[model samples]
Target chain A: MEIKAIGCEPLSLKRVGIQDGHTLKVYQDTGGYVQLKKAFGMSPDEIIQHVKDSALRGRGGAGFPTGMKWSFVPKDSPKPKYIVCNADESEPGSFKDRYLLEYDPHALIEGMIIAGWALKASTGYIYFRGEYNYLIHIMDRALAEARDAGLLGKNIFGSGFDMDIHTHTGAGAYICGEETALLSSLEGFRGHPRMKPPFPAVEGLYACPTVVNNVETLTSIPQILEMGGIAWRDLGTEKSGGTKLWSISGHVKKPGVYELPMGYADMEKFIMEDCGGMLRDNKLKAVIPGGSSVYIMNAGQILGKNVTLDYEGIVEAGSMLGTGGMMVMDETVDVVETTKNLSEFYKHESCGWCTPCREGTDWLVKIFNRISVGEGRPEDAQLLLDICDNIEGKSFCPLGDAAAWPVQSAIKQFPDDFKKWLTKKANGNGIEANI
Target chain B: MAAATPTSYTDKVIVSDEVAEFSPEIIAEMNEHLAKYPPERKRSALIPILMLIIQRERGWVDNAGVNFLAKFLDLEVTDIWETATFYSMFNLRPVGRHHIQICKTLSCKIMGEPEITEHICSKLGIHPGETTEDGKFTVSLVECLGSCGTAPMMQIGYDFHEDLTIETVDQILDSLR
Candidate 1:
C-alpha cells in the first residue's frame, strides 16, 4: 500500500510515520525547525500579515480567518497571553486532529509557535481529549525534545523571544472543545464554557489575551510559512485556502483520512473514486456532510444537489463543512431514532452551567428518546423546535447551539419520521415494538 | 473540642490495591496541575485527579476509590463523588471489557444509527445498558461519541467505529474476541 502525502505531494512516510506519534524524527529530518528559524527572523507583525494575506481560515468548524483572529489579541494587554490548540476531537465523526497529533505533532508545535509569535504570547497549551492517552505521550516527548533543542524555551533558536508549550489532557468533555471552555479548563476551572464577545482574543486563559485555534488550523501554518500565502491560496477556493484533511468514515468502501484540495467537487465522486465507494451494495440513506454538529441531509437531497465537498458547496446545501467528518449512512435507517440518539449525547455532555443548555438538551433527549422508542406525542416535533430555540444563543457557550442545530434541522428536513413515531404510539405499539 | 488533625480522616478511607497503584501517577499529575495554579488553591486539581484515578481503574469511581482520593487530596468524599458523577466520563457501574458506546445523538440518529444500534443489541443478545453474559461487550445506548459525520457510530475503548453496520460491528466484535 502506498502512503498518502499532505497536499497531494509525494510524502516520505518516514518523515510522518503512520505509527501512533512520529512528530519528533519527522521534525528532525524534514528540517522542521528551519521554519522556526525563518520565523524568528521576521517581526511578529510581519508573521501575522503573512497569514492574513494567505487567507488561511480556522479548520475548527467556524472557518474564521486565522490572521484576523491573531490580530484580535491586544498588543499592550497586561494579562499573560496564551495560545491554545483545540485538540479535543469530540465532534461526532471528526478524527482529523487525531491523525495530525499522532502523525505530525511538530506541525502543530510549529503552528503554535507561529500563532504565539503573531499574538505575542509566550505560553501555548494544547488541550487534547482524554481518550487520546497515547497521543499525549507522543506530544509530551516531542515537547521535551523541542525544549532540549533550544527551540521552545528561552531564546529559541538564539532569538530574543521566549516561548513554551504545554500539553494538557481533557477528561472526555466535548464542550471543552469550545475556545472559552477550553480556556476555563486550562485555568484549573470547571470545563464549562464562558460567554463570548470578550472573546478569547481579548480575554482568555486566566482572563488574559489569548488565541485558541484547532489542531488542523495550527498544523496548516508551517506550510503557509514555507510555501508563502499566495502559493497556499492557489490550491483551494477564493475564500478557503490550502488543502484540507478529510476524515471520511461510515458506509464508504474505504473509510480513512484523505488529503484533498479544498474545493474538491462531487461528494459522491470523492467517496466513490478517491476513497472507494459505499461499503457493499447498500443504498445511501443519509449523509452528515460535516461533523455531527451540522444538519443531516437525506441521500436524495445530497445527490440532487450534486453536492461538492467544500465550504461554499456545503453551505449552499444548508449545511456547514464542519471539520470534514463526512459520515454516510445506508438505507434501512430510521431517522427519528437517529435524532433521538444525538439528542441524548448533547444532554449527557451538557455541563449544566447554563439552564437553557442543560435543561433544553435534557428535554430534547427526552423527547427524541420517546419518539425513537415509539412513544412520541403529536406535539413532540414543536417541542423539539421550542427546546432548540430556547437553547440557542441563550446558553453561555456555543455548544448549546451546536447541540440544538442538528435536531432542529433534522425535524425541518424529515417531519414524517417524527409523525410516524407519533402514529406508532397511538396504534398501541410498545416503544421498542416499532423497530 | 480540639481541632482534628488532617491525617485522622485518612484512617477511615479504604485504599484498594488498584487505587494504591494509581496514587503515585495521580499525585504526580495532580501536582503538575497544581503548579499551574496558586499553591494554596491546590484543590483545583481535585476533579482532574479523580478523573485520572477513574480512568486508570477503567470506569467508575468506586466508594473506596473516592474515599481514597478524598484522603489523598484532603477533600471530602462526597465532594469527589459529586464531581465524578457530574461528568458522563465516569461510568458509575461496571462496564463490559469492550464497552460499546453507540451514538444516539440527533445527527447520528438521523443518519440511521438507531437501526445500527438495534442490530448491535440483537447480535450481542443484550439490550442497551446490558452487558453480554460472557462479558465480551456491554452495549450502552450513549449520547454522541462525537463522530457525527459518520453517523451510526460507536466507540470501543479509544477507537471510534463509524459508518456502522451489523456486519462491521460483528467483525469488530470478532476481532476483539
Candidate 2:
C-alpha cells in the first residue's frame, strides 16, 4: 500500500500515508473534506475560474483542460446537470485509477462534491469499471461514511447546495471509458460511443448538460483548490500543470505507480533509477511510452532521446502520454507478437458501431496473428499500414484509431521483426519452424 | 425457482423456463440498491441486480434471471441481454465452480502469459474456453484485469493472483482442489 511521489510534493497520494487511509475518520484527520468547505464558501464561478487558472488537464488519456471542459456546460441549462466520474480504467496497462479508488475513495468523493458545485450538478455518478469489482465495496463504504457524517447528501457544509453521488458499475467494456459510451452504459444499455459535436458537456447523461471527469482528474480537484491555482500551475510544465502518476509495468525490475511532476527529466533515467531498470538485467527493446494504444518507441529512438514524462513530451516522441501507462519491453520480447496481442484486445473491446472499427480491428488482429505465427506474406506489412490508414479517422470513435496506432507504430519502428516473420515458416503449430 | 411459461412475444424471444424470484430478504437488499439512484433512473441498478441474479443462480446469468431482471428493473429482455453480453465478467451459461480467468492481453502476454495459459490448460485437461469434465474448474482467457504492474495474473472468481509462476499456478490449483 506504499505510494511513492518522487521529486514533487504529493497531493493525491498524501492521505494514503495515514492508517486506514480509505476510512472517513482517517481521511478527515488529515484535513480531508476541508477543500469542499473552502469550495462551498466560494462562488461556483470563482471555483471554475480558479480551476481554469490552474490549467489542470484531464488525466484520463485525453489531456483536455479540465476547467475548459467544465466551462462548456451551459450555466443556464434548465435540464438537470450531472457530474460523471469515469473510473473505467480499462486501458490495457493502466491501473492507477483503481489504486486511488481502492486506497483513497474519499478523495474522489470530496473532489466530486466540488466538481458538482462548480458545474451546478445536482447528481453525480462514479462509472466504475466491472473488472475492479472489489473497489465498488470500498467506494460504497466510503460514500456511506460521507453521508452519515454530513459530507454528502442535501445541504452539504450548510451551503444550501444539494449534491448526491452514486456509484455505477460498468460490466466489462473498454469502449465505455469513452465518455458518451460510459453515459450509454450508465443508462443501462450497450456501452457504445456516440458521435461528438453535441459533446458530453453540451448534452450528456440523460441528454442534460453534463460534465464528465476522470477519477484522477476529479481527485486532483481538492488539492488544486487547497494549493491555489497559480502555485499548482508552477508545479508541472507550462502547458501541463501538476504532478502526473506513471503506471510503469512490463519488464521492469520494480514495477509500480510513481507520481512525478510533469516534464520530469529523462524517460530512460526515470525507468532505470525509479523503476530499478529492466527485469532480469535484460536489454531494453522498446517502450510503449503510455498505455497499449499509444505508439511504440523503439530502443534506438529512446536510448539517447531527451524524452520527458508529459503530454507534449510523449507526443514529440511520436506517442501520446495515454493514461501514463508505460509498458517496458526487454530484448527477448517480440514486437510483432506484442502488437498482435494488443490488436486482439482492441478487436475484442470494439463496440461494433462502425464497419472500419468493427471489421478493421479484427483484420488487424488477423494480420498480426499471421505475422506472429510465421505465416506473414511479404506484402502483409504494407497491408497492415493500409488498413490502419483507413481505420485511423474513417471510423466512428477513437477506438478505431487506437486499434491502428500500435500496429502502425510497431511496423514503422521495428520492420525487421515483421520481415523475419515473413521469411520464416510455421509448421502446423503456431511456433516458428526453421527459424 | 418456479418454471416460467413463456408468453411468446416471438418464437425467437424465448426466455428461460425456470423464472427466478428473489426472496423477501433479497428483495429488500435490491430495494436498498435502488434507493441509491433517483426513482426514474431505477434502470441504473441493472448491473447490481444482474450481479445478484448471477450469484443466486449459481454462477451464470440464465434467461430466467434476465427475465426476472426485466420485470424487476422495468427494462426489456433485449436490454438485459445487451448489457450482460457486453460485459466480460458475466457468464451467460453455467460456469464451473471455480472459473480461472487468465489475462491474455498485451501487458500480461509480454510477461510470459502464453506459457502460463498452456500450463494451466494442460494441467486442468481443459482448453481456454472449456470447463473441466468434473465441472470443478473452467479456464477462460480474459482481457487485462488492470493488474498489469503485477503481470502474468489470473482471477479465480473475484480474487486476483498475480506475478504467477508455473509452480505458483500449480499451488493455486492444488489448493483449490
Query: Each model's C-alpha lDDT?
Result: 0.73, 0.85
The candidate 1 chain A region of ten consecutive residues with least summed lDDT is: A10-19
DockQ, candidate no. 2: 0.68
- lDDT by residue for model 2 over A1-435, one digit each (tens)? 225888897776776555699999889888899999999889988989878888889988888999999999998889999999999998988888988998899999999999999889988899888777789889989988999998888899889999888887887889999999999988877888887989999999888888889899999999889988768877888888888888888998888888888899889898887889888999999999878888998987777898888888889888889899889999998888888888889999999989999999988888777767667776788899999998999999899889999988988888878767876655433333221
Isolated chain B TM-score per model: 0.78, 0.87
- Winning candidate number (TM-score): 2
TM-score of chain A of each: 0.93, 0.96
TM-score of chain B of 1: 0.78
For model 1, residues A1-435, the per-residue Cα lDDT tens digits are 112444456221224444434656646677676777798888888888878877888888878899899888899997778888998888877766776777788878988887787777888888877767678888888888888877788977777788899877676778878888777665545677787778889988767888999988888788888878878767777777777777776677666667777777777777666766766778887777778788888766776467766788888887889888777767656677666666777777788999998988988877776766666766778878888999998887777888888888888777666667776675574343221
- Provide the lDDT at B136 for model 1: 75
DockQ of each: 0.28, 0.68
Worst 10 residues of 1 chain B by lDDT: B4-13
What is model 1's DockQ versus the real complex?
0.28
Model 1: per-residue lDDT, tens digit, B1-177? Answer: 953422212332343333434557656766775564446545556655666554557455566667667777667766666556555656666667888887775545655776888887887789998888887788877655545445567788767787777788789888988
Interface RMSD of each: 4.1, 1.6
